[model samples]
Target: MKNTSALFIIDDVIANQLLELDDEYIGYQVLHEESFYKHLLDVQEFPVIDEYSNKESHKALLVIRSWQEVREILKEVQKEKNINAWKRLFPCQLYADGAYGEDTIIQNLSCAERLLIRAVQEQKYVMFYC
Candidate 1:
């Protein structure tokens, strides 16, 4: 469990279930670590973050967003096909500078980006949290 950041959109029933018994929650692979958090921050989509437990804080920090907002941000992020888009939303120091370093981050996230986009399009609550 190196990184705990989870970006997902789920139906209300699933959200409610997890709210009750989070032990059953299966983790999603973190697409981008710092950039994902920065993206949430840039969009002002903050919920309570549980800093102490770190990876285990997902249940405590659960937040729901309307699919419209999710769609808009996803659209903006999906454009660049590179970390340049993420860097534009975030800051310089968070990522290593150079094409190789940046592309490493961006290239691996294609599947995650697609899955998240699908979730958003389904009009579920898109979330970024534990």
Candidate 2:
């Protein structure tokens, strides 16, 4: 099996909650626009790492609407860095609004988590964006 980690650009409150929920299983790291940009420039590459088996590692990116621009930026990074395999995961619903509808943010998170788990089990490198 391949090991995996997650990078989040979300607010501290949500990031902290996610960390608490899966501290042992999922590796968590914070990602900010400035820092991420700096890293990308410094490394002259996208923020990616090799996990188990020295193969492509699963990477998940969590960001809010304010930072949604990163989505397109990452696509460029992927192309420049030659990342052929990656999955983009995102929140199916908006959590900021009081849309206490059936499609809750938690449900989306759970579903994404499940998909990630499966991808890891299958030794696939996935890039989840939310």
Candidate 3:
């Protein structure tokens, strides 16, 4: 049960570190990137946690994408069954915080999904990592 999760950041590595985080990134967030229930299944990526990560050496710009790109990737995730299953498993998303069920458990995995939605709606690229 590794502390796997994703979220939005200020696009500043230093800030990410100050918050006691690791692997600050930006992009579609593959875990959040949906698929059609094929070639993808894992216990990671979800639960909107921007203030509760365990990583202590974090924050860095890993990927950058335009609003258009972000939307496209998010659209892909919308088709993936794994992503939906995660949400269904955690109706109360926050329950996912500090939660673990499978060999590959990631706390707050749903956060990536929420972050993607917000980024798309705002038409802005957000920093994320897991």
Candidate 4:
């Protein structure tokens, strides 16, 4: 099976509600491949990683991250001079093939960045789930 992930920027209210739910679904979620975070984004750690026992969940692995950190990471990622690297990691066919029905890494990163901007303006946090 293909690995997929999603990023969400939400206020405390929604985050709390999602945590209370039975892992049904989440809203305002920008979907991407798992490598989007590891390769492109280069995220070394995820918030709330220590809060959960099961790192591998059949439902969804939820982790909350700071918007500031996300924005900073995006800023650094955008500084990458090699466009080919992005293309290599996020080939168009990845999304077109419908393996997980996700957007290209760049597309989802843009969406996630926009969400981070909104989160910063609204004083919120970015939540990640895989």
**Which candidate ranks first by TM-score, i.e. highest?**
1
Q: Which stretches of candidate 2 lie over 4 Å from their true place?
A: 1-103
lDDT of 3 by residue, 30-78 (tens): 3343331122222344434323344323422333345566676666554
Q: Please list the residue runs of candidate 4 whose C-alpha ends up more than 4 Å from where it truly belongs after superposition.
A: 1-58, 79-103
Cα distance off (Å), candidate 2, residue 28? 27
- Evaluate model 1: give its lDDT: 0.44
- The local lDDT score (0 to 100) that residue 79 gets in candidate 2 is 26
C-alpha lDDT of all candidate models, in order? 0.44, 0.33, 0.42, 0.42
- Tens-place lDDT per residue, model 1, 1-130, is 3243344434455445445644544343332344333333212121112222243433334444566765666667854464555443222323443433445456545544654566666666555444
Better TM-score candidate (1, 3): 1
- Candidate 4, 46-114: lDDT as tens digits: 222222213444444456656676555545455135333333322233334343322344444454445
- The order by descending TM-score is 1, 4, 3, 2
The local lDDT score (0 to 100) that residue 15 gets in candidate 1 is 44
Ten-residue region with minimum lDDT total, candidate 2: 41-50
TM-score to native of every candidate shown = 0.41, 0.23, 0.37, 0.38
Per residue, candidate 2 scores C-alpha lDDT tens digits across 65-90 of 22333334344433223322222333
